[model samples]
Target: MEHRALGRSGLWVSEVVYGNWLTHGETVDRATATACVRAALDAGITTFDTADVYALGAAEQVLGEALRGVRRDSVELATKVCLPTGDGPNDRGLSRKHVLESCHASLRRLGTDHIDLYQAHRFDPRTPLEETLVAFDDLVRAGKVRYVGVSEWTAAQIAEALALADEWGLARRIVSNQPQYNMLWRVIEPEVLPLCRREGIGQIVFQPLAQGVLTGKYQPGAAPPVGSRGAGFGRAPRFIGRVLGDAVLDRVQRLRPLADEAGVTMAQLAIAWTLATDGVSAAIIGATRPEQVTENAAAAGVRLTPDLLTEIDRTLGDLVDTDPTKTADMFAVKAEWARA
Candidate 1:
């Protein structure tokens, strides 16, 4: 797999990062999860992403076990905080107590001395931004976290945090932002991308396939395939329902011919399209089976010509969501939940 520098930092990550979100410790069993991780390593993927909120921290345990035998220095492990890991008030958000305790808990679960990248899962409206940054800076100073980042944060939120970090002379600034980006979801392009580009914060994008919609497996006018995420096989992600509409599915079908012309699967075409975008350091792909990992990993270095990209845009015209405000809207929803 080809590697790229994560923003302006010296850290390098594989173009295709294997992530376990809904699969590990949720849908797929531990043995299958380990197999998928092995497939990722076999494909030369050195970066793995997980979160404390996924399956209420079971995902990290599964991922930690999967990478147990691999050389510690040979891989970059990333996880997130700021999500509720329990029902207690202190169990969530980016408060200093939560952030510091979460870091130690994540370290114990991942079986690592320090995290390669520790991210704020979401912006905490309930906590002071400086308190959050100070906690992250403390983790860096204490040698628990190497780099700090945020997920699905608005450009304004990021700018405010960066300004505070600079003003306070924190040990580390944000290095990356993890957002859900795909051919269908272009919300980050207009605002977040340009801001991060200028700020040197690379994007570690998730759901590059639009929660499997871009894979063209869901039919336009039919029930979702059995056992698929849309079929709700096992605790499906809530976000997948938004993209399962017939309008989106019909437009997604139009991209199949383009994938055919490129001599790649629908999934590969979708993933390759994300990598082609500037300011993207890596695209995270989750897999239940090892062969799926192998198939998606092949998209890491595949180049899409300008003509093909234009054709894709033309085919999916008007079906894409490009509103920059969607990021803030999502943040607001999460913030309300935090208040509750």
Candidate 2:
């Protein structure tokens, strides 16, 4: 697998990260999940991303077990905070209590002493950013986390945190931002990309395939394939709804010709396209079976030429969501419950 720096930080992550957002504990059984994780490791994927909210912490447990024998120092593990893990108000948000407590819980669940990247899942409007930053700073000083990051934070919010970190002389800077970025979902392209580029923050993108819409599996004007991600299996339906429409599927179908010409699967083409975007450090992909890991991991080093990228754009014209206003507010809509 190809490796790139996590922003300007010394840490480097695999170009195509293996993520267990919807698969680990909720969708697939433990054996399947473990096999997929093994597949990722065999494919040279050194980076793995998960969240405490995923499967209500079972995902972390499964991931921890999956990496049981692997050397901890050889892999980069990332997880997130800032979502309600319980009903109590303190159970969620970026308050110091929650952040610190969540970090400890995650460490125990993930079976790791330190998280390579501990991200703020979303910008907490209720909690002060200073409190969040200070808590993250404390984690680093305490040697519980190696790096800091935020997921789905707006450019303005990221800038404010960066400025505060600078003025306060925090122990570490936010090195990464995890956002949903793909060929069909370009909402992060305009503002978030530019701001992260300027601020020296790398983007670890989630849903690089638009929740499987870009894979050309959801047929236009036809019911979704049985057991597919668009089939509303488990909690995936909540996030897959936006891209399951006939209009989007029709446009996605047009990309198969391009994929055929490029001699790559539609999924790989979609993944490679997202990796081509500016300021993207890595693209996170989820899998149910071990074979899926091998299929998606090859996109790590596949570079698309300018002509193929242009062809893809022309084929997917007007279907792409580029409006800066479309960026979801994690605190408001909750459209992306799986991630920030």
Candidate 3:
């Protein structure tokens, strides 16, 4: 696997980060989860990302078990906070109480003393930004979290946090931001990508394949494959509906020719495209089977030529969504905290 610096930080991670978003605890059994993790490691994937809220933290527990014999320092393990792990009001968000408690719990669940990177799963509007930063700073100082990041944070939200971290002389600035990025979803491009590039924040993009739509597995005007993720087996079927439409699927079908010309599968072509994006540090892929891990990992070092990339752009020109308005406010406090 190819390795890259994680957004101007000293840390380096595999270009293809193995993530367990919808597979680990909920969709697959323990044996399959362990086999996939082992396959990822065998494929030289050094970064693994999960969240405390995934399968109610069972994902983390399963991931931890999978990595039991592997050397801890050899891989970069990351998890997130600010998601409700329980019903209590204090069980969620970036509040100090929740942040500290969540980190401790994550460490225990992951069977690691320190998380290589701990991220804010979403912007916590109810909590002060300074409070959140300070809590993460404390974790860093206390040797619990090595670096801090945010997921699905708007460009404006990241800027505010960066400025505050500078002002407070915190232990670490946000090193990364995780967002849903793919050929079809360019919401992060117009603003988030450029700002993050300048601020030295690397984007660890999730859903790089548009949740497998880019794989060309879903045919236009046909029912989704019986056992596919789009067939209602995975989590968050609501968002998949956007990409499963006939219009989008037909456009995606056009990319198969390009994939064939490149001597790669449609999935590899799509993954290679994301890795080629300027500000991306890693493209997270969630796999259910071991062979799937190996197949996607092939894109780690595959480079697309300028002509191929241009052809891809032209084929999917109108289909792309770069309007920038599609960027969602996960915290629901855009009016109060967003910059003008």
- List where candidate 2 sits over 4 angstroms from the true fold: 329-340
Q: Give the TM-score of candidate 3.
A: 0.95
True-vs-predicted CA distance for residue 263, candidate 2, Å: 1.4
Candidates sorted by lDDT, descending order?
1, 3, 2
Note the Cα lDDT for every prediction shown.
0.90, 0.88, 0.89
Collision pairs in model 3: none
lDDT of 3: 0.89
lDDT (Cα, tens digit) per residue for candidate 2, span 47-152: 9999999999999999999999899999999999998899998999999999999999999999989999999998899998899999999999999999999999
lDDT of 1 by residue, 1-340 (tens): 9999999998999999999989998999999999999999999999999999999889999999999989999999999999899999999999999998988888999999999999999999999998899999989999989999899999999999989999999999999999988887788999999999999999999988877888899997798888788886665647576667677788889899999999999999999999999999999999888998999999999999999999999998876678888874432222322232
- What's the TM-score of each model vs. the native? 0.95, 0.96, 0.95
Q: Which residue runs does candidate 3 get wrong by more than 4 Å?
A: 234-236, 329-340
Off by over 4 Å in 1: 328-340
Clashes of each: 0, 0, 0
